[model samples]
Target: MPAYEIDGYDNLIAGMVQPIVTQSIIINQATDAKFERGTVLARTGFTEEGMWVCTIVNSEATPAEEKVPVGVLADEEVDATTAQQRATAYVSGEFNRDALIFGGTDTIATHEAALNAAKIYTKRVVK
Candidate 1:
């Protein structure tokens, strides 16, 4: 008998996202090696030249800016272990509440208002 490998897909988006607005951002390598889809992101407030670098939203982050939820990562997986990787993020969209990823002790309630301010809405999906 041969061993088999199985992979499952996780649907992150739950509602319509007309226009499909997206933003190209750099995922800071220091933040985390890999991030799954629907991972909440926050701008580190640092820009090299012009490209913006972002990290997972952390409630305990200092300076306040980094604590703000900016958007949700749109990539299935982004590996930035070696160096910062450029990835697409949904700046405005409706996402599945249960599918979102957060850093530290943060939860959906911790970022609901911030996300809404950024035009990112979250809703529960029964499936």
Candidate 2:
């Protein structure tokens, strides 16, 4: 996995000190691996932001038994031209969108890098 570094900022009012801290780790993916509702996807080096917005995209048919309790999934099966296409899609459910934030002090370049990393780290489906 490819890795990168990001500089995070924190401010101290008492000391009047603004410190830039570096966070190093492997890239994060925008797309997540396909899993059933009950599946427990491991949370590894994902940062607080990552964990906040982290979601599993279902790329396959959901079993009736695996349905989420919150009435998220509308259908058991998603339509795809081929199995390959289907595997790239996310599951039908109410994903956690609370992770999104607006108007932060972070630089636009920094945010762009993070977004790009997500694309690179996306999970792949096997035929």
Candidate 3:
């Protein structure tokens, strides 16, 4: 399992925070192994019951790498893939528009500054 950290701003103001994750996600593979604590995730879209399924966010270029982080997964356990109350919301915190997160996959083609975008310290995926 890969582990990602929630770096950058820790002392975020209450208003800048948003609910990027949902509580209790029902997924196709419900072993619960995919939901590692602190791993960033994306949605598997909406279900018939209007629930958004959660999965590990995959990198576009690397595929095995992380993607635009929606938020961090809280430590949990559930066995059913298509289960109710199987997920918890991992929220996002951005202090301002300049807020940096360490998981962005975009790169500039031309010359760029070291701090071209908001940056957060990220721990790479361990295969």
Candidate 4:
């Protein structure tokens, strides 16, 4: 007889507002590197082939836009190490703060205002 195995999934979103808003964005291979579910994103304010490009939001970045949190990555782990890839992002929604990934000296306190401004709310999930 052969042995079998099973896998489990993790949910990053804690809650959502009515009519969830999402956008198809291009992950910048040179900047983003890799993407995991619930990774915060920011617009690079540039596009390639007519699609908007984005990368992980960095609080220490010099660019104003790069320091702003615009969306949350709503996909499974994406390997953008080799080439740019298209993925979906939650433009506006409620998410679990514990599950979110930050970059470059960013913390929930640092980007709280920016996240609120963008209509992306995060909740403290007790678990």
Candidate 5:
């Protein structure tokens, strides 16, 4: 067997890192309103807490927001020196554990257990 690197990356340890993708939207803050980073969001039907990141809205969500989990506000404020962040508007990309209903747990559960845990994920991660 042989170990190797590709594209200047240490291939042997590639699995150690998982880069989750995210996006941001202007929540249209008022005089005192502001949103913070790592805020979970959805298209429609928000609750008092959880399942939502921002407290403000630009307008009533059109057709239940972007039709899927629009990711979170990767950048809560402007960056004077550089871009706050970068991401795609719409696409299935990796997200931090906070994006998931159940925070990232590494337990190797059985099929049924994993399915049970992933149920809410399936419903919220997207439409």
Candidate 6:
């Protein structure tokens, strides 16, 4: 399998909804080269921190111009600038890893679920 680069953002919106936006790069197998760009997945929301988990099901790459309709569920209306800022902050090592699980979970299921869901959006880029 080819190596993939995953990058995205998630913001808690209203109710139990958290919008997740992702872009992934799929390496080209034929030329042993990186794909030109990535593809957007969806514009849907997931349950906030519980109830369910979303893992990286899979990914594929294409041209950047090809816009894929991804979901967005933010409590506050997020503009393109804000989204870009969040993405940059994420890539710039501004987020706290431990803060993700600041409060201890009451149950193993809950903790495991949060970890699994978080792994989908966790990029190790240190800036």
Ranking by TM-score: 1, 4, 3, 5, 6, 2
Which segments of model 6 are wrong by more than 4 Å?
A: 1-101, 105-113, 117-120
- lDDT string for model 2 (1-127, tens) is 1112223521111111222121222212433332322221111324554421122221231442211111111112222222211111122221222221212232223233332233211111222
lDDT of candidate 3 over 1-127, digit per residue (tens):
1122336643222232333323555545645434435444555567878876656554452543234444445544333444544555444432221222223453322102222231212222222
For TM-score, the strongest prediction is 1
Query: Which residue pairs collide, candidate 2?
Result: 30-118, 57-90, 57-91, 58-90, 58-91
Q: What's the ranking of the predictions by lDDT, best on top?
A: 1, 4, 3, 5, 2, 6
Better of 4 and 6 by lDDT: 4
Preferred candidate (TM-score higher): 2 or 6? 6
lDDT of 5 by residue, 52-125 (tens): 32322222335534223444334433222232222212112333332332112321121123322322122223
Q: Compared with the true structure, what per-residue lDDT tens digits does model 4 show for residues 6-27?
A: 2453456667553458888888
Per-prediction tally of clashes? 0, 5, 4, 0, 2, 6
Residue 69 of model 3, lDDT score: 44
lDDT, candidate 1, 72-91, per-residue tens: 88877788978878888888
lDDT of each: 0.80, 0.23, 0.40, 0.77, 0.30, 0.22
In terms of lDDT, the poorest run of 10 residues in model 3 is: 109-118
TM-score of 2: 0.17
Ten contiguous residues minimizing lDDT sum, candidate 1: 1-10
TM-score of each: 0.84, 0.17, 0.42, 0.83, 0.29, 0.17
- How many Å off is the CA of 29 in candidate 4? 1.6
